[model samples]
Target chain A: MNETSAALEVRNIHKRFGGLEVLRGIDLRAGSGDVITLIGSSGSGKSTLLRCINLLEPPNEGEIIFDGESLALRRARDGTLVAADQQQITRLRAGVGFVFQNFNLWPHMTILENVIEAPRQVLGYSRDRAIADAESLLEKVGLADKRDGYPAFLSGGQQQRAAIARTLAMHPRVILFDEPTSALDPELVTEVLAVIRDLAEEGRTMLIVTHEMRFARDVSTQVVFLHEGRIEEQGPPSKVFESPESPRCREFLASHL
Target chain B: MRWSVILENLPQLLHGAWLTLELVLVSGVLGLAIAVPMAIVRCSRFASVRAFPWVYIYFFRGTPLLVQIFLVYYGLGQSPWVRDSLLWPVLSQAYWCAIIAFTFNTSAYTAEILRGAIQAVPEGEVEAARALGMGRVVTWRRIVLPRAFRIALPAYSNEVILMLKGSALASTITLLDLTGMARTIIARTYTPLEIFLAAGVLYVLITFLILGGFRLVERRLNRHLRPRTGH
Candidate 1:
């Protein structure tokens, strides 16, 4: 409760699918300008944790305090979970951006329209301001020239960068990246990492779940290694990578890193 | 094959074509109005919300269009409640009854086409919209609806052409559309083959015209799929 200064705090979050527990009592927090990279083997619940952060897959049991306000949730009659206060959830989501592995850009819209859409429709930005911000974000992501092109025409790397620009257009306080490079070709990884590296350099708060160890080691201020749906070890990247206390962490790092 | 009889009926046949065009046009526009919302509702999470449209699509699509026309025209007309209602004046006319029946029938098919298209849209884009804080309504308007409409275009065009042919059934109700005029001409001139052949050709011409219009729309909407000119 005293961690109100943090931009995001997840306390004892638990998620289950049928009888399988995907995430079990996980705890995490991110402060302003903190770049926390979560490294885990596939199915260690990394993506589910990221999704739970934004209530995209609302956790069965947890507290998600974003920007100091705890989320309000209710159990539906069918024993399903839903946000208790929809308006507040909307406001909370607008402040937190999520980047998907596949770059989920709207295929029907041009890059510029895709980038400007959330700002205009969700945040109520004026057309002029949304376009202006979108242009600058595109420039930052090195995609200014491709603003008018549809997603189908772009390279996988270019599409991922465009997705980043779209996320940046929201001016989010905290951004969640769910394995942003997993869907790209090996050669396309660096361009996206470069964009994210720049965001980290700008002192933006980010929570990244990635398999790219070198990039995580390079960009993360804090590194977390998850094993079997729990954080096995977490600290400065040097400690987690160089001298992991947990045997599971060392085993995971040996295999993936 | 009397040249004099054929020449004398040309003007009346053209007028019938005009009436048939009006019926198709009115029904098409009105049907779209019903189809869009009903399609969206069909994808709703609540069972009760989806039930009405499911039954509507089942009833209209399952039964014959001719039966639908008869039910609306004769069955509804025979009811005392309908005869005494505010809509009685409009319902009493065969023209309005045909319009009502055609609109209802076409709307069901269009709704099903659109519902399939809407569901076919990738779940990723919809999730992305929500991740960016878009409400359900905004997500549908900006993302779901437009993309689904593009996907539904070819199917919708077919539905309309079918409706254009189906509008011929209005003749059975005494609306005197293209087929009705052909029947009248056959009765007077006793040339069933010539009169029916002429009517079939007129229907083919209108179908081609509508197909051309839809092609233009498809081109405009799908310009995004075309490769960029310079790069």
Candidate 2:
């Protein structure tokens, strides 16, 4: 891909927790309208890699470039990459939205409040404008009637949809999902995946770490297989799932399927 | 047993009851202020910030409130430097000393209660706030502290009632609080049972008022969690 066409680029990213190396020398790139699905075993660093994209867990080494800006790279007085300040990283994070495994909705807030909070507080939208935008987004996610309810009162699927609405309200360029359906009951998983499918249809760029093999195969434009902190194989889902080139990918798919 | 005797001493008991209410009000407000910051420090990530309140809470909570009152009233009074210091003007007064002792004693317990509540706030909520790009101060104001205070409220109300009962210790410092007035009446009239029973009634009334106030606050704060009528 050309340098200007890439929406997100991870170059030689490494993350470690003391003795444990969670991600090792990982590199990836996604185009503006691409839906990249990462599939792997439980501790293969798929979620950790997604979190690193937002600087939620800063990588121990390497750089993450979003759009044309370097998210993990700091420019010096002479305009060179060094170490980014935490403040700049936080500002960069505003450009990316994340959906957690457990549908981390703010329980204290109404569904409407949860949707509008980031827009009003982070983006400095006025109350009237934020509410207007939030209502439309809630309607988009099919939660317009549940706007006044607390998250606890909602089903798992409903909460996940509300979470999607909350993230979309921020108008983030890239949305990340960390196993968005893992915590849901088997029956509820389809509804959450359906919302994700709708987001993909709208040409919203997405990076998802998930265990749902069929959802990945059906929805992903690209699929990455991660094993033991490394990308074992990756390509179009038709290629990766149907004809995984690597022995590790074959083993992983065999175990899961 | 005479109704006339009870009526004659009613004025003195009422005055003391007023003093007891004053003590509880002053100490409860001061205690909450001290507790919130103390609890924040107690749960801090840094070793020093965490250690400071750990010691403060341990000493204050480990010791009996009665002993703490005696130590402040008598032990500090025995110090020549304390007696001569500029602070002596305030500390020398029995009322101020009692307030200081009660405030400190209740603060230690309240801080622990608050710390548990603050810690009990789900990790997901904090993560959600951070993801919203809220600064530490705004997140604390909008999310953390409010929820923490809500969780701590029940325990705090119990502490307030305990502090009201604890105000009885103020009588030991020669303050003419409710229990002090009751003691005086008992000594003069030699009707310990009748006079103390009258004082007990006043305390029950005050406790009920406090309970009512907390119920109102709890209902308002938890309104969001209540089920909606139409939905």
Q: Which has the greatest TM-score?
A: 1
Off by over 4 Å in 1: A78-80, B1-8, B226-231
Among incorrect, acceptable, medium and high, the docking class of model 1 is medium
> Considering summed lDDT, which 10 consecutive residues are worst modelled in model 1 chain B?
B222-231
Q: What TM-score would you give candidate 1 relative to the actual structure?
A: 0.96
Give one digit per residue, the lDDT tens place, for model 2 in A98-203. 8999888877789998888888887889999999999999898889999999888899999999999998888888889999999999999998899899989989
DockQ, Cα level, model 1: 0.75
Candidate 2 deviant stretches above 4 angstroms = A72-84, A255-257, B1-8, B74-89, B224-231
RMSD values, in order shown: 2.1, 3.9
Q: Compute each candidate's TM-score over C-alphas.
A: 0.96, 0.91
Per-model DockQ against the true two-chain complex: 0.75, 0.47
For each prediction in turn, the share of the native Cα contacts (below 8 Å between chains A and B) that it retains comes to: 0.72, 0.44
For candidate 2, report its TM-score: 0.91
Q: Residue pairs in steric clash, candidate 2?
A: none
